[model samples]
Target chain A: MEFDLEFALETVGPLLMAFLQVTLVVTVAGSVVAALLGLIWAVCQRELPTPVRLPLSWVLDVIRMTPLPLQLLFAVAIFISFDGYRKFPDTDVETIGMILGVAVFAIHYSTYMAESYRAGIDSIRQGQWEAATALSLPRSRVWRAVIIPQALRATLPSLGNWAIAMFKDTPFLLVILVPEMVAKAKQLGGASYQYTEVFTVAGLIFLAASYPTAVLMRKLEKKLVY
Target chain B: MSDFFQAISDYSPYLWEGARVTLALSGGGAVVALVVAVVLGLCAISPVAVLRVGSRVIVEFFRGTSLVVQLFFLFYVFPLFGIDLPGMWCGIVGLGLNYGAYGSEVVRGSLNAVAKVQWESTTALSMSWPLAVRRVIWPQAWGLMLPGLNNLMVMLVKGTAVALLIGLHDLTYWVEVMRKDPEVGLWIAYGAGFLFYYLIALACSSGLRLLERRAQRRLGLAPSKTRTTRATAEAVA
Candidate 1:
């Protein structure tokens, strides 16, 4: 049977376009948060005293120990109940909900990335730190000039994959009825009674969007000259 | 007082049943993933142009989509085309296929890492292709792939939660069901769910860590992560 291209386009056109922004915005923002905090965590993990480090580990552990969706839900529920959020009064609950959803996901992933960064950090030689020391490079300069850039290069493939995951995870915001891609399809289906076409189109659209990156990942994985 | 105990005592049966479903999905999916990985892995490395291109595209297609989305597609959409199947089984199949594609990549990567010299050595030993594969190649390929397989197994366990989306009475689904009671208390509903997932994930990770340690011991491999960090950390410090 032939596909209904026009019907699929009309239904998905708006939803896909809007949700695409939401997904990209959330992913880019989340990646920014993850990179900054994860880098800080990785850097501090080495030089910090055990007292500060030990408690920080516990916080990271709790974040890691929980599921992302639960954390998302918890963050939304807590934030939506706060006095400032309540005082804003005119704020869109759904936007607030979505941002909190993305933030929680970012925080959760950041902790994991932090650990991954630590692994990447530790993988660097002990001699490099001594050389930086011998050069009398200031601590911040050493980290800025030398350490973090290399650490992040190693972290990129994972961080990129997680960003891809974060992009896909925008659909989970549908649990809170945010108008994400899946939610858009759900709304269209519920309104138009065409769940099959709507959801299928949504998936295909996402597949279309994601295909380029996945292919690029495979290609870059190859051609490792070193 | 007895509320926490009652909550536990009441849900133990449901929890056990949920655990069983989780195990069944993970076990079935890992087996399917392994088979799929081997086939796709072989095809991915095959000299035949069509096989190579066909396997890469198909693997990429599955890996790009969300597993839950795929699970929904299998459960909801296929039936529209008149392919009747149980939702749980669809979830099983989807999880298997989704992970299979990923496992295939890991498989290919691991197999590729085997030194080129081994094949020459095997050829010199006068072993046939299949024999060499069975003896020299498979063991080394397996040794390299085991850590990856271990990681994938942990994912498959976590992935079992997607079953909840397809209306499976997995732990997450049941917990949501149980929590529907206003008396279940939001904290209890969520805390229980969190605890269950954490325990399962912990169990799976520890099991994987054991397997990884075992693989490292048997094959005596140091994970590359160790050295890369050592070099960089020293360079900066």
Candidate 2:
């Protein structure tokens, strides 16, 4: 059969969109988890006792150094055997896969987020800490009031950029059979030898999504410069 | 643990062979990436309007898309157009283009970060444009570019894992092969895989650190007293 662009688009487009919803959900959920966990790690590493800090930092380094796909595979091997991995007997396996996929992505990205947060924290004026101390703010109060707010503000662009990265990386979940967009495209390709058309459409979908988000991120970065 | 040792002893030869491919792919891809980075990076900063716009478009297109798709395209689609490449070449070219896009930015940023006075003084000395870039600008920029390039080299090592997805018998592929053996437990197999990758990354990082120090010294950005530093110091004046 000829390479029918119309047939490929008509047949594969909606399937890919359905998968895009899964991708978006994972990206949002994973970004939130990563941002929170990374911030916590950054703060803990700096302030916690040496007994807790050193090993935590070493683990973060390992996480940062490893390729993400291997970590996803490792997560699957580890989590699939758990009794509670499915969460509910009635839950679909794909849903469980999505949850595990998000967990792995969050864990992997949290290390990078920690580095970004650490940089933002380090960039804060030393006098800000001294002034907070002079004002008799407790350590927790100092972090909540003076530190995290500024750090998060400084790091918003990076967080947004990482969210976009998470968006691209959702395809990795396909390795565990999570049926993200690329997986759907592959399924579509198998039905007809139009892998080219299907993957092109899939790539365009990613570009269409990523480019606008990147532009918006650039705008946010400019606006947030204070 | 007993099984782990048995599998390692049995598969050590295969794993070493795989490790060799992994290093070769990363090393070869890094060379291609560095060439692409410097060329496109220079084009990006060139005075010609078309060159800048053309390089920017090329870089953005590569950077914007997922590398997996790029590899897939190179693997699957190229044969359709009658330009068939070997499996490993697909991985190398895909990585070269993707990370080259990234490295170009590092090159451009560092080149731009060189002190503006350096450029102006070089121009005032009646050096030609290319001469100014080579003699005055690049020496300083090279030092700044080293750390970013070093980071990219480590990233390249990790990225070599994707070659396995495209059916290249790289380290990750061998790891999967060994891991799939019912005799070898998953934990041990994955642990060994992680060890191999981590060690490669660690070596790449330290090697690049030595190169960075040399670059810094040549640019006199380091504190070490040396003849090169003295010459660079005089040249800076």
True contacts kept of each: 0.19, 0.29
**TM-score of the first chain in candidate 1 relative to the native first chain:** 0.89
Q: What is the DockQ of candidate 2?
A: 0.32
**Candidate 2 docking: what grade?**
acceptable
lDDT of 2 by residue, B61-148 (tens): 7767777778878887677777889988998898888788878877887788899998889878999879998988888888777777
Off by over 4 Å in 1: A51-62, A80-88, A190-196, A217-225, B1-6, B177-184, B220-237
| lDDT of each residue in A1-226, candidate 1, tens digit only | 3455676778877776766667667778887898678778878778799999989887776666555655665565555435547776797776776678668778876876786688666656888889999999999998888887776666665565556656666666655556667766766766744667777787777788767765554354342212
> Could you estimate the TM-score for every candidate?
0.86, 0.91
DockQ of each: 0.35, 0.32
Q: Model 2: runs farther than 4 Å from truth?
A: A1-3, A83-89, B1-4, B222-237
Interface RMSD of each: 6.7, 8.9
Candidate of highest lDDT: 2
Q: What's the fnat for candidate 2, on a 0 to 1 scale?
A: 0.29
